[model samples]
Target: MDTLCGFMRDIGRHLSKPVVMTAEGGYANPVLGFDPAADRVVLLAQPRFS
Candidate 1:
């Protein structure tokens, strides 16, 4: 997780843009708190499929 976060941070630094993290279903909490590079975290409700 730390490694991934580091990589994301590096990418954000290189791109000079705020990275947005979208949560689908699993691992939402960690992505919200752990990702420092993510400027915004969007939590999406589960979609219902017909």
Candidate 2:
């Protein structure tokens, strides 16, 4: 999660628009807490953690 936030912040510096994030293949992990750095998060499917 720290890596993701850091990457977002680094990329956001170059862009004029807000960052929208979506992750794949992280269903096995717990749901992530929201980060203020990201303007929006788009989850296309429900995550199954088991």
> What C-alpha lDDT do the candidate models reach, one value each?
0.48, 0.50
Q: State the lDDT of candidate 1 residue by residue for 1-50, as single tens digits.
A: 56655665666666776444445765543332223344433233455599
**Candidate 2 overall Cα lDDT vs. reference?**
0.50
Q: RMSD in angstroms, all models?
A: 8.1, 6.6
- What digit string (tens of lDDT, one per residue) describes model 2 on residues 1-50? 66875566555555634454545766554333333455433343466699
User: How much does candidate 1 score in TM-score?
Assistant: 0.42
Best by TM-score: 1
Could you tell me every candidate's TM-score relative to the true structure?
Answer: 0.42, 0.39
| Residue 7 lDDT, candidate 1, scale 0-100 | 62
Off by over 4 Å in 2: 23-50
